[model samples]
Target: MGLKSVLSKVFAARVNRELNYLRKNAIALQQKTFTDLVDAAKDTAFGKAHNFAQINNYQDFKANVPVHDYEDLRPYIDRVVKGEENVLWPGKPKYLAKTSGTTSGVKYIPISKESMPQHIKAARNALLSYIHETGNADFVDGKMIFLQGSPVLAEKNGVSTGRLSGIVAHHVPAYLQKNRLPSYATNCIEDWEQKVDAIVEETHNQDMRLISGIPPWCQMYFDRLSAKAGGKKIKDIFPNFKLYVHGGVNYEPYRTRMEDSIGFGIDSIETYPASEGFIAFQDSQKEKGLLLLVDSGIFYEFIPSEEYFNEKPTRINLKDVELEKNYALIMNTSAGLWGYSLGDTIKFISKDPYKIVVTGRIKHYISAFGEHVIGEEVEHALMSVAKQEGIDVVEFTVAPQVNPPAGQLPYHEWFVEFGTPPANLQAFAIKVDKALQTKNIYYFDLIEGNILQPLIIQSLQKDAFINYMRSEGKLGGQNKVPRLANDRKIADGLKGYIS
Candidate 1:
């Protein structure tokens, strides 16, 4: 036990108390957040245009302001981007988190001074919660690394702009500065492969204890480290490493392979973070879902995922959310986004203290033949079979194969990269198909009716996904292959890598 670890335990206790209060008063906290957001922005251009001054409650707000995706809100965002003050919020935004989207192309999400602290605090508290629950804080004294985009920023209209991960790198607490790895110069490398190589050189022999990033990038780092150390596992290179904090993608599919790469199991914390806000974090090792952050500077709304594409979807507040139902997430944040559609879908597993699991992306799914399979379902089905058969799946993606050969019926196609090839590939496919059929009834019905064939697995060569992403110029940072796509864009791109 070092001095830092001792002090962290005491600090963790205090933070836990504050989190408990937030959990206990979840609904009240959300209501207060909603009221504060509306009141603070009442005089802004958007507020005035939306009748925010006359709104008294959720219903009034919903009636006055319609849910908006990026395109719908582009006019106000454009004004803000042109350096206009008080266009969306009371003042100019502190930063713009730039991201790429399918329809909108480039998006600049605001990060107001009022909302930025919530992002930092939510991430900090997630670690503190882990320390409070597990009583293992010694890792605080060792080196930490967050495999992310370059911390470099570009300025537009005097506002700093970059990838959300890169923007967050600027706010890391000063106390952890000395313990953080890959020196500032290394992190600034523009290319990801070069960056990882630089990171491996800097941290392979350091006293690393905590690692954070999305799973795929972290896996890439592990592979680089293993090669640098001549096939030594991650645990051997960094014996002190204890916790892995991951977000932006589900960790389940990569868990087995990642653990094997490390040669042992380690604790992990899942988080729900987006450019717009930090919504939740895994609060307990024993719990299944990430605990929702009601006290954060955001108000949440949900619409049943099935109805998301409808002209007028039914929106429900936090208090009305039901368990196990998929809903498209909506947000009204202190950053000045009002009724903004977040594009992600989530399912509540517990309502007493408000815990949710990221289900899938609203736009990422297979519905060509009306099967409508989601990210969560396909992941669960494949991982379930993988676990049972001791298979080491590196990466995978699903797409609807709408037009196959002349005689073959249209079906879902799965492209998978396997570390250890299965003995019987066709038999393995049948098992995965059965597992998916159990998870999605529509797919089963389609198969039974001869409307579609069983999903075909396209075994991919080593680094197939990496090659595909690299070819598309999305090789690193926050870019990830979608788990499911309605079109053949990704499936067609992956054809060259088929084993």
Candidate 2:
């Protein structure tokens, strides 16, 4: 066989080897991973303060570490920012990745020397796994475009700081960097508009065989590229483009738009990496959910979503998890975060290979009128209706219109940005509403009891959500419009927007 064929086979073999090993020892590996993490941070101040030495296994560790959001860990992270060693981990953090969450602004998550590799390895393996599964490794020989935050990292308290993607960009293997598009200078432009313009100009003609980024920003890039190339579909511009690796947001709403941009179907790989750790990734072509990373430097725990808001929720590990139930993801990583609530929810779709689907954020859902609807339901509802009506959703958010002005009743409000609108808009809303009522029993009951009126549908002007995000000063780079809000704060803001 030729050298290219031989190399492709070798890459497949390597990834399959890891996959086989994981399949064989996943349970034991998960158990040992928790042990390793506990041992590593048992002596840190945060660990010592929690009496980590006495923690022997997942149960003890969970009881001792206490599930924490960024706010709960802020004080300890602030100490790490001040040159403190062994505060959470053994040494000072190499950098702090800054993220301004829509609900909570300005969260600084620490990235340690030990935890950085997990991010890099998980991302690398995700691609490798896809390559092996599809038997397509030739794309590695060509250029790839990664729409990441500016590679220009800022400094705070003598520690490097930047977006998580920006930090990962810094660690892209040097060989691969040679083919990555949007040169360093272009990526450094802080203003997203300027950066995107420069990116379109710089590499619209490059031999790009791969593309990776958050869905919305990448969609923006694709649209601009098409516009600049005289209405060329992305596939026409980069004929060799083979893979689209996406993360940082659910890709469902953007799927139709992205496919339309390319003008053809393409394979995609989804990753569940966060600033906290690289959690899970799509490891199979036939599979529907991400395979949980068993050997990554992070250990996993799950709290059932129903009990997540309880005074004391049940947190379980791999051995005890069940299928088809939504659970809040809790993680402990070698990176010094012990029992941190990553704020995301997931549902296991498989047990043999240990795969999961991201359900949504712990705090991101709508239950405004006693109709508890989670992210998974909303996404499924949108995707179902969009597919049935042959439309493409750009972005959307749901909020309940509570407190009726007079004789009217409270109902759910849907603000949808559609790329393709059905001719009958009334039927479109009816289909979407019926889909939600089917998925969520609570919502169905409200409708049945006459406690809630029919859902209202408002067509969002194109880029309405984008404009709202831009107004928030968070136009791109991992920033997303929250899929569901508890209150009308975001809904009202979007109403006042140009959309």
Candidate 3:
């Protein structure tokens, strides 16, 4: 083994020990993080406005501060963007993670100096944990690639600003710089397709062992590689590739096709990260969910997802969460975000060390007819049926078809791009509809009452989703199609590619 690979094993052992301590003292670690965040920000403008000085406990903090979405805290954020110091967090934010907002347009989330290391640490620990568990550090000697947005950042009020991934790209440790793939110049290419082509040209013959990105972009990279190699499997192109690290979306929908593209199943690590904070990561391959990072520089709160929109929803601390129930993830971060709604829902699978699975987005659900179908249910239904029928799904989205054609009942419309088309499309649709009904009772009741018909599958042509995403100028870099929507915006846009 090379010196770096030997050192990686040693580092992995040390990190695993620290992780065990954190897991064993999960509640205590969370309590300390909570207190630390409140105390650190108590002198800031928001702190003064919210009575943070007088807060002594979780209850005190909760009573003093209210949960805030971007708009709710925009006034303070606006000041920070205008170069105001001590407006939100301590003095000045180190960087603002720019993200596209739905209702609010462009959103700038603060990333403080203190909070920055937490992101880097959590990501590093995820890999180290994998190395420790599997005793595989040989990949450390090989090239690694992360498909991401350009690293070139812009100045906003004298603070560096860019997409979270781009901001993170600037922080890759010096030790790994030599092993990282896709030359900086290639990565800086503005267009994602061009970037992928450049990346392929630069790294196809290298000793690639670790590949990381959101699954869709990784799929795109694999497709480009296959085309270049005359349809050869990805395993043939990079025989040493050992791990596939992904986040931002559930991997189940893309799992079958990704494995097929690679010609084998591979180990994957799922992480739960956001502009707000690095929340959790897969610490064990045998575990079912990502281990929540109780020791990270963020304090967590959870509101029962069903009660999220209700007036004054019940918010509870991490220690109060129960298994199997979904909750809207709320956080108080060192970045000066207090009671910030992350807009994502998660369900705890294990409480011993606080492990969770990303369930869906709070806003991304279909309830046009009051059925309230979520991303998890739809993904589960679709993948389950597809598995039983021996089919391969490339990508899919679900939107309510409230207005159907003449003489037809309104129903849920599923836009599915199939890698392997079913021999009987109607039978496949029936199986998926039945599977969905079993997952959600509301949809089942609606179907039985004739309020909604069984879901109709709009089989898409090859690369339909890729084309749609490209047309919308969201081809890559943390972009993903919503699994379920209440309206037909995406459904309408996808009409042209329907087979």
Candidate 4:
């Protein structure tokens, strides 16, 4: 290995060692003073001008400071955009991570310099955890491919205006950096069309080992790669690939399709990445749930999902959190967000303090048809059916659609793609329908003709859904197919291939 590789290995080793030390001493670390956390947060842009006095102190801060949704912080975000340093924390934010809000349109989330360490540490811990679980740290020594957004810094009026990814790319260790294939292979730097072309070209003949990114985009890239390789399997192209790191959205639907397209059984490592912060990561084994990076320059809170939706929403601190209960995740990050609800739901899988599973998005549910189907429930039902009926469903999307006749009640339509045809496709569909009915009571009622028709299964052609996403200009980067659609609009839009 070269000097850079040697240095990176050393750095990675040190980071791994530190993470193990922290994990071994997690209980003691959890006892860290809230005052110190608040003080550190104050030093960043988020806490600078905010009245810590209003909340009194750390104890009162926890008691009185209500959990805030993106809407509640809109004014603060606006203030930051207007050059108000106090609202965003103190120093000028380096960049704004542009993200889509559920009700709100586009949001530009501020990221500070101090928050960079947290992101890096959390990501590193995730990597180390994956290594510990899978015994595959050796892959890190090889060239890893990050299927991410463009690293090209944008230029407005001839000056460099970089996004967060571009800024972070510069800080990646030179050894790891060298191993990275040219940006053209994975980055959407130029216009969308041009970026796709670049990605196709750059990934042409690389010995990529570890692939990481959103599922939809990664799948699309593989589709293109598969086409270019003239129907050759993914193993034929990237023979060195060992793992697939995915985050940004749920991976259940795309998991089967990915393995089918890639022609291998590489492990899938899920991540809990948000514009606000890199919150958690899947251990390498891909069996245990994600591990939260608690001490990574952020203070966390968990409001019970019911309380979050109640008339008088109540919040809970880390100390009050219980295992296996669903909660709306909130965080006070080094990035300056205070009591910010991430708009995601998670359930503790283990009491080691940080092991949890991303259950679902708070707003991503299908209650329109009275099914009360959330992402996790749907994923579980789908996985169960797939296992019982022996179907290898790669990717899927479920939406409530008005089918058969206009006045008829809506039904859940599932678009699925399989790797190998099950012995009984009809029986598989029946099992899935039954699974949905049993697991989700609302779905059961709907199937009983109280609200809707039985679930309809659509088996898509190989790589068909991926092409559809690419055609919509949402192929790569952070975009992924929505698992559950509550309205008929998105459902109807996907109607052409109901076979």
Best by lDDT: 1
The global Cα lDDT (0 to 1) of model 2 is 0.85
The stretch of ten residues in a row with the least summed lDDT in candidate 4 is 154-163
TM-score of each: 0.99, 0.97, 0.99, 0.86
Clashes of each: 0, 0, 0, 9
Predicted candidate 4 versus true structure: per-residue lDDT over 1-499, tens digit per residue: 4454345455666766777666566545544634555665554344544556454455678655567888888888777666665564655566677655558977767777777766766766666655554445566666777766666664332223454555556567554776775563346464544565576687778778888777777776787788888998888898878888888777776677788888977777788777688877775473578767666666777878756777666666665678888888888766667778888889988766458888887777787765668788888888887766667776777877655576666677777767666676677777777877777786787678657766777777776666667667665566667777776654565566545
User: What would you estimate as the lDDT of candidate 1?
Assistant: 0.93
> Candidate 3's residue-wise lDDT over 1-499, tens digit each?
8899899999999999999999899999989998888888889999999998899999998888889999999999999999999988998899999998878999999999998999999999999999999988888899999898888999988999998988998899999999998888998898999999999999999999999999989999999999999999999999999899999999989999999999899999998889889999999998799999988888999999999999889999988899999999999898999899999999999988888999999999999888888999999998998998899999999999877899899999999999999999998999999999999999999999998899999999999999999999889998899998888899999999998
Model 1 TM-score is 0.99
Local error of candidate 3 at 203, Å? Answer: 0.5
lDDT of 1 by residue, 1-499 (tens): 8888999999999999999999899999999999999999999999999999999999999999999999999999999988998988999999999999988999999999999999999999999999999999989999999888888999989899998988989999999899898799999998988999999999999999999998999999999999999999999999999999999999999998899898898999998989999999999998899999998889999999999999998899999999999999999998899999999999999987899999999999999998889999999999999889988899999998888899999988999999997889889999999999999999999999999999899999999999999999899899999998998899899999999
- Mark the regions of model 4 whose C-alpha exceeds 4 Å error after superposition: 1-13, 24-33, 40-50, 54-59, 131-141, 154-164, 184-188, 191-194, 284-287, 369-371, 401-410, 417-427, 445-452, 458-464, 467-472
Instruction: Report lDDT per candidate.
Output: 0.93, 0.85, 0.92, 0.69
Instruction: Please state the error at residue 385 of candidate 1 in Å.
Output: 0.7
Candidate 4: give its CA RMSD in angstroms: 3.6
Candidate 3 off by > 4 Å: none
